[model samples]
Target chain A: MSRKPIHRLPAWALRTNGAVVLLFLYAPIILLVIFSFSASRIPGQWGGFTAEWYATLFDDSRLQRTIAVSVRVALVSTLLATVLGTMSALALERFKFRGRRVFDALLYLPIIIPDVTMAVMMLMFFSQSFSLLESLFGIGLSKGFATIVVSHVAFNIAFVSVVVRARIAGMDATLEQAASDLYASRWQAFRFVTLPLIAPGVLGGALLAVTLSLDDVVVTQFVAGPGSTTLPVYVFSLIRKGVTPTINAVSVIMLVASLILVAGSVGLQRANASRGRQQLRTSGGNS
Target chain B: MAEAKRERTERRRGFLLALPSFAYMVLFFAIPLIIVLVYSFATRTSTGSTSLSDWNFDAYRKLGEPIVRNVVVRSVILALVTTVICLVVAYPFAWFCAHQRQTVRNVLLVAVMIPFWTNFLVRNYAWRILLSEGGPISSFTEAIGLGETDILFTKLAVVIGLVYAYLPFMILPLYASIDRLDRRLVEAGRDLYGSGPQTFRRVVLPLTMPGIIAGSILVFVPSMGAYVTPELLGGGKETLLGSYIVTQFLTARNWPVGASLSFVLMAVMLVSTVVYFRSGGKNL
Candidate 1:
């Protein structure tokens, strides 16, 4: 393969630039991990290495509880977002509609809107409508588990829809038509053909939803009640008191979890893409 | 008759499948925004209950106040700075990824995205430590014969933080566009006696304009409204539209003013995005 003349630039220049960018990105993260193990009470000054921070993290019941709450919110929100987002993607992609473009733009509005604005608006609406909500549905809407889940699902749906819609657009519609022509009912056609075809997109969207919900602070901060604090909120409040190694320990754990989930998602996408290619080849051969 | 019934059933199934998303948007997205719009016009009582009153443009008028105007101007400027920095830094990185082999590209892309998965607040706080007086960054600077003054709270730190946080947003779209670029075009330009800069200006630049616009919108909009980074790194000296709105409601307890400010912020962002997209010749 022919290379561009830019490749003729001194090798050290390219290597040095790339290294600087990478270091700029990853150095703080590395420092965070290292400080988490430092015995020093201050953040910048590193003493000897110790596991005291991890032990301290375990000892903090409030942090533990907040983690549990965040997990619950992330799990439920991811599930809700995946289901709604997949259906929306299918509809937007497969159906011809008058307002399809409008719908698409509107769906993405939440994602583009600033989180602070969305959070405050959500707070105002829920608080103002609490009585109405209770009278109508026998449920009170306030800053709590229910509210957090709703907020997360609302925001995550946009991301989920975008990812799934792209995948749906890339898929061939003829397979579903062929399945239906074989005397399969609509449900069977969807199950046997469309669902599997879009499963990778769904998984990718769900993984994103989970990561976003878990990492959220602003929206969660606005909607969480006094009794319901997620990990990020707890950490934010903790920082006001001053930095601690325990916070770093928590960050490292989150970092590891996110890395695993992202790796899994990429692997799944590759598998799906290869499968799609094979299916295309076989269909072409038969035709 | 059976087939007709089956078709009807299929239509119903599609409607049912689409219902959840429709309801989700209507309830959370549409209604809350409607509430904000109404609150922008309504009067906020001493007790904080918003009520319909003689409709007034007082909130809109408040948008012109010096404090509000300053915050708005500052936010826009900061966002523009962040966007430009992200583009400058991300362009080379995206180009690098695009030229790499498939495996390498995937690895690099994953690396770019991994930091995004971590809590943004956590990452911002990491920068706090990095820029503090005794932090690695300061130490490195001092070691290189630069002064060891604290950089944590300055506007410089804020820009660095914003750029680092949003660089991925700029990189991803550029990578997608550049990855799809036809290499032959560049070769053809070179054969026509075009220099490196000329080929980049005429061919690669115009081709990636759409990606640049998309990435700018993604970075600039959020950077303007970003509270966590500025608040953490700005050491309470720098205030953006976001922190201002939050302070109005939470600290100041002026719900009407907060509601009004939030609406103004939204309006500014919407107008900017529309203008940006329109100027880029893309359909919103």
Candidate 2:
């Protein structure tokens, strides 16, 4: 709330710069939304507005299938990632064990590595594994839905663990200790005390995991086998072919879905923060 | 003895809790990287299938090739430009955001996040629409009597897309650092006869150096490894490191080359990441 003017730039210049940058960030998105409804087949040309693109999208079974695949992959991967990541976060935050630094670095690797490298690495991994299996046991496997889900979980775990670890780190450890001192079992301490405190973080991590899984393209593109294309990868393919009203509609849908997810995350965090403050105030009064 | 036993039990519990994640990373993440490393040294067959035997440094030697060098140089330049542009554009905006009232700051931060969290491919596709031959920018220029501009599929368009995509990465960290700035220090510097720019250079700049380094690494690493933006906006005429690496795998069918390129890119990213954390990049 403190408005201290530290920089000497003219107020008008600073305000104008802010406006221009916001416009730069948003103009394309606005244009994309408006033009998706345009009746013209050409992207820029605007005929009378129509909802034909949305109608066409409904009829595109290929798009529908890809969307379904994406959702399934995201849901399954997010579930696995939430459990694994939350456990890892608790371990990292609360425990002192051997090789902690190396484990920490390993956890961050998926997030810091470039998408292209991860993609190619996954490609090599799945292919080589398949050949090894085939040569050894005459059983073969290929990249598809399972590979996509596995890769999604691999990266999503890192993100989930980071978010959860931050929450766990900020939480007061004495609450659980107090529970135990009162003769509560460890499971009771965790379940009754720790779980509620970290629920927002868990939900936030799950939302992030779902969003990343849905939005992935580079990794999915490489690992996706026959009939395994997700929505974003499918959209990328459509763009490569040429821009169309269908692509616009699909893009808008994807954007809206993620917008809702992000909004939910922000809302949850804000609510938890206020509740935390209220709890602190009440606890202070008791003290 | 009882205390020691309890401590050992806690340690065992912690290890048990962490074991699943560690195992998953090893199997899915680390092993794949090791496979890439091994393949980087394997022999490429005439039919493009990799042979496990007859290892050589042929793939690593390909790094000195003229074509590969040109792509690497181009990618490095483009990434540097993107990083510099993002910094120049984001610094003042982050300062402005950080200086705002609480409500206003939250709104601005949310505005930044909306785009950041949106689908990456869709956002780039939006730019493709905006910069297409008959798109909005072209239409606006002609309407303003500047004549039509063919900006799509050019390196300039690619730069625009890169900056657009990664600008928020730069902004968020800068905002966090600037918000943490002690305004009293600035006032002190000014009272000591420091000019606005002088105070900024001597005090504010050093304080936010971590954010600057972190933001630059965040933008530069992805820009260097960018495949989608260049392929989408650059129209595939120019081959950057990302597209080049992909081409080696899919089109050229040279797995060794692709693996080696990937290994080098990951190494560069890993080093930058180490530098980023070492520089006290706490915001990210």
TM-scores for chain B, in order?
0.90, 0.97
Relative to the true structure, candidate 1 has a C-alpha RMSD (angstroms) of: 3.0
Q: Model 1: DockQ against the native?
A: 0.53
List runs of model 2 lying over 4 Å from the truth: A1-6
> For every model shown, what is its TM-score relative to the native structure?
0.92, 0.97
| Structure candidate 1, residue pairs in collision | A143-A225
True contacts kept of 2: 0.79
Error of 2 at B217 (Å): 0.5
Q: lDDT at B161 for candidate 2?
A: 95
B8-57, model 1: which lDDT tens digit per residue?
Answer: 76566656666778777988888998888877786666776656775776
lDDT of 1 by residue, A14-116 (tens): 5566667778888888888887788888786689989888888888899889989988999999999999999989878876444556667779688778898
CAPRI tier for the interface of model 2: medium
How much does each candidate deviate at the interface, measured as C-alpha RMSD after superposition? Answer: 2.4, 1.5
